[model samples]
Target: MTLSVTRTARGMVQPSGQTPTGTLHLSFIDRLPVLRCNARTLHVFRHGHEPAEIIREALSKALVPYYPLAGRLKESSQGELQIACTGEGLWFVQASADCSMDAVNYFDNIPMVHHEKLLPDLLTEVDDLDPLVLMQVTQFTCGGFVMGLIFCHSICDGLGAAQFLSAVGELARGLHHPSVAPVWCREALATTAPQVYATGKANPPPPLPFLPDYQLKHATMDITPDQINQLKHEFQESTGQTCSTFEIVAARMWSRRTKAINLEKDAKVTLVIFANARQLLHPPLPKGFYGNCFFPVTITVSSEKVSQASHAEVVKLIQESKSMLPIEFTKWINGNSVGDVDPFAPPLAYTTMFISEWGRLGFNQVDYGWGPPVHMIPIQGSSIIPVAIVGTPPKPKKGIRLMTWSVSGPHLQNFLEQMLNLT
Candidate 1:
């Protein structure tokens, strides 16, 4: 399928007259290492109303509460990021694809060359002035369409973006207001005490020299519900405890990927996962606190252990790592010095895997008057650490769709074989 651009425009979703206007500082959570990067998402719908008109109108309403999204990001003298609430517009593009959704196999294993056509390009580099978010609405010949969004990680995280998008959908459906009000409490995570580091941003140094480049390859695969259940059952029977689907699946992938690369038996490996802290903080954030509210949990083990350990064993290790969420979040909130290491840093020695679960993120619930999205996918596949983007399966099906991006090395085939054979 080929996509042709029809229009390129920008719209300013100004805050209401009563809304306050000023520079808003980024919270500690917002400055997390990986949060500085940009992320993309695509929402697919069938035979929907005029998506361009609906989205523009709904976005204006959403921006009244999500004004920061319309603002421009700037760096402070200390090198920290802050939103300058100038009411500047966001970039939006309109395009049409020559083929229908089914013709592209519902975006299953979409070619990398074509993926760039579906979303906005990554900024050459993070600069002082740039749109916090960019979006594209592409219509297919069969009347189906997709909404692609690229958001700067400095402004918000996945949950924040989802909340704002949900508001747009609610407004498109003619709701008088959003289901949840947006909240900003950056001061709560700020400190009156002076800091000595550069912006206190603590951007980590580059990875050590030994890490091998993976040549950046991407693929999407699915895991049947039965496969998930079987793994869970086996782990429970062996360990006398049940594990969440994500924990089990992530552990399995970590084990398999390490073995696939034929790493030295005694090399070190690490698995990193971010846990939400909205309700985990000492005094929980507001119900709709829309910002970066998560911390990364890293688990290090030897390659031999990661490759040879039982599924139950790895899951237990992940569980233990997660159990420290509250403590870690509190430390970040109190302005304590957190590790300078990047959570998504490249795995140089043995292996490093970062796993993110979007199934419960309500990707399928962002309805814009013509029912919910039929499909969604994230752009920006990484080549450093292997990444697994897991989402809920299609309706009436019992399973998950796993989209992974890795280096196109000799290990690629073995890694994929192990993943597919798990079912």
Candidate 2:
């Protein structure tokens, strides 16, 4: 029989204590054009005792300091987004699967389509009164559980999400208070220049085209430690400079993806890479300030330039783009600019590439008494543009896992050749 998940219980989990109620304005970073959506992640735990209940209870307590999560999204009279801390609570669901962890290979090999079922479904388009946080815990027959968490992107970035998840884990372990007291200083990130935001509100980017299921293909490939080392050695030999593994992989991905898609020589191809911007601020955001602070480092060039460029050359291009992040961030924070493209909502006909690096986002560090999760993956894959997500390696594994989505006919096969043919 095909395995299935059954929801045993579901409800709103309220805070353990009275939470402050008010209308909290969002930060400038929180109002980015591309951040008006939900973020999703699934975590796998191989062993745990009543994890669903433990997490459910812990979530209630976790909502006190993170009270804004218990609230709903609302709009101000001036048509700006803000939070109404109603103490309505977060949506929680307890579920059980008919199969064991081993049945699915600990979810390491599961398809992205199946991951969609694990997360709580929400409207593709969010609106006022929508819950900011929604979560579900599906317990496996073998005492393991998979936690599907979705939070508003406007509230936090990947690193900020990690911070919130870590709090829930700590509370589940019976901690009286979070190690890092949560901070809500959105004003610190307020922008002096509001034209970009105001203009975005008036003329939002066009809606993304959701391709038919058959037209999209989701695939992944692993880059092992040895392979990474070899690439680093090759890069240093050729360029006489050191770079992160992401720089090498992303550079290669851009180069091969451009060639595989067969864009016009003069066609414009863009790459948007996710990078942390907490320290890029003049004085830096305060610690424990969980909010949207990731900046998309973008670079666009002619297809002829990227597709024909050497791997080392492509890496240099990405490096140059990244090096400009500090200046770009400074300008944006001061309201002097809006990025070339939105991080999540890039503009393109068929030549946009997006890369989000999750290896250092702290997802692997969240542990709920039973110990940290052994594996984690995002539930995604239904976009017209080619996108790649690099996640932290699961336990006992080294290096990173690449999850890719492309609508092109030769997308996966060509990408595989690019990954393996590093000669």
Candidate 3:
């Protein structure tokens, strides 16, 4: 088969040996990179014949700007680049097929769930599991394809990674330059010698609090359009409040979870809201400032209160929590004004973490030559069931997608049933 290769900018492809040129952004240098983990699915379409050459060309060109990271695969001398931080991060693999590409195109169009139980098994196989990044491409028996990506948690937040993927997509589509340049602002993090100071003086800090231990169970629940409307009506009826899908689902799950854990009345059952701080910060971050750009805003209700609260009340509590996420609070956190805690420590807040990225903020606009991904799901981590709320596409009538980690099977089932009842 004759291959057609298109090279737009000669200099864009930096040779393998060169260091990243251009002035290193200072803030990016100062702060440790925040890790963001997620995945994207792609569907490849061929017109009559598979454009293998064109696809390869697009991938190569798109990956050029990210060449530094891609090229690091070739570099063994740089120990930092080669070393894996916690034996639990990214990995790359491939899947192959024997049939024609067209025969498999239909299968590529849909979304597939990565089974939860398979995670530990998957993790064990990858060397240096933590800090491991993966890019797995599967080729079906026909010409169809699937791509899976896994990122670490300490490098970039979800938004940051989305920004990076957008760039790659633009490049793959033959854009000479990315619409938004990547930003690096790690230096902006406060420069206190010690992360925390005791009584206004520097002192060795006490051991950080340990995160609660819990196993996650995953299940898929469906809600009908009528059911969704009913749930919305019931929510307003119960608490004189209108709630987003996230609020309703999150509230039900949180309540049931606390009940199952048997948390005490006096103990705080905190629902952490991962609020994006990008726009809130003074001199808002540039489009490229992809590090950890979100902070936790929490609502700590007594377990008893939570158990007794109506769905509306929970929604309101979630809404009120947003008020605590002012940019100043983040500034305080980065400045060490608040109690200093080790960045590497296990989660300090009460165990639960909720993250939402439902509205695609141009995240799906990433159009490598193939087209934007149909779905994206986060594989849950060990201790926490980080809930990622995603917006459903046009065809899938599902109200919303809840990607959760480490939730109990029975509790999750109960929460879904309750949600359906409310609906």
Candidate 4:
């Protein structure tokens, strides 16, 4: 189905109170090289109760506490990225589509091509002085609407973005105050860089663009409570060690995808885990610190090891990745300066997997008086590396739903079969 815009408007969501006049230093995790632009997403509501007026009004109030969101991305004399607290405001757009909610499967299964229409255009809406956040409320003929948002990664991670939206939902429901107050303590997570002794400094490497004419195949698979528990039981029986829900799921994926691709046995495979650092900070961030407080923990091993290894073996590697907290947390925080080479970059090889955990983010809990959202869809920005988004089960089941977007390849069928048979 084709989507058309019925009306469009920009809402100047300003801070409810005066905001400090200065640049907000972006923490090391916030300045990741790959996350330099706005990360787009789609929120679908089946029974259209969210009106443009309500959303805009609630957003204005929500911006009061998260004022930095209304600021623009700018660079300091040292060439470091920071949020210039100008109170410029966020961009709000309203659009309408010709299809019904059922026509698009209620967004439970999305076609890669239609995603472009459901999201705001970054090429035109984003600029150096433009607001760091842009939102579009797209309405459907059947009264359903999609809330599309573009959030600058330099300002916050996915968890931080959810914190802001939760506030908006509360305000829309006529709440006097947000459940969690927004906190800004970017400098608290800073770490001292260890001294480096080298013969000479080499010129920085250049950025790599996405693959040429890449095709993206998107799929959503659901795991049952019984299946989850069974997998955990099997792993514990084999290794005599228990694993978290995330560990079991990630291990299975690593094993299946690697075999499906049939890569060389000696090929190196890296599992990049995006870990949260809110509590890992020495003194801990405020209750609702809404900034980039997560870092990537990458574990690399030969393809033969991961593909042929049991789920328990893979889980052990993932646990090793998470164990880098506290001890490694200090070195990671202090080692990199503002302009230093990005601590990490997107994997240049097809053998790597990037896993993101969204189960605990509470995307479904965000209610704007219309009840909770039925589905949350992450718009893919790049297609070179395989990316997976793990979401909680629909009900209070012990399992989760994993959505993956990967470059179209021959191994898709094998990968899909293995994922479906995990039970």
TM-score of each model, in listed order: 0.89, 0.92, 0.68, 0.88
Superposed by TM-score, candidate 2 places the C-alpha of residue 174 at a distance from the truth, in angstroms, of 1.9
- The C-alpha lDDT values of all candidates are 0.72, 0.80, 0.48, 0.74
Over 4 Å off in model 4, which ranges?
A: 16-18, 121-128, 194-205, 209-216, 336-343, 393-398
State candidate 2's TM-score.
Answer: 0.92
Q: Provide the lDDT at 175 for model 2.
A: 93
After superposing all C-alphas onto the true structure, candidate 3 shows an RMSD in angstroms of 8.2
RMSD of 1: 3.4
Worst 10 residues of 2 by lDDT: 196-205
Candidate 4 residues 1-36, lDDT tens each? 554555455555676667667777776556555567
Model 2: how far residue 172 lies from native, Å: 0.9
- Scored by Cα lDDT, where does model 4 land? 0.74
> Model 1 segments beyond 4 Å from truth?
1-5, 8-18, 121-129, 192-212, 332-350, 394-397
Record all residue pairs in model 4 with backbone atoms less than 3 Å apart, i.e. clashing.
Answer: 191-333, 191-334, 192-334, 193-334
- Each prediction's number of clashing residue pairs: 2, 0, 37, 4
Q: How accurate is candidate 3 locally (lDDT)?
A: 0.48
RMSD per candidate (Å) reads: 3.4, 3.0, 8.2, 4.0
Off by over 4 Å in 3: 1-94, 97-133, 190-213, 223-243, 259-262, 331-336, 340-353, 358-363, 383-395, 409-413
lDDT of 3 by residue, 1-423 (tens): 111112121111222233343222222212332222334333232221233333334444444444323322111232111221111212334344445444533332222433221121143543432322344444444444444555443345667666766775666567777777765565554344343311121122355456555555554444455655776788788778677766666676676556655566788766765567778765677767766656667666688988777767776787777766684455554563445543323253434545565445555555656665544444444444445354443223446655455355556665456544542
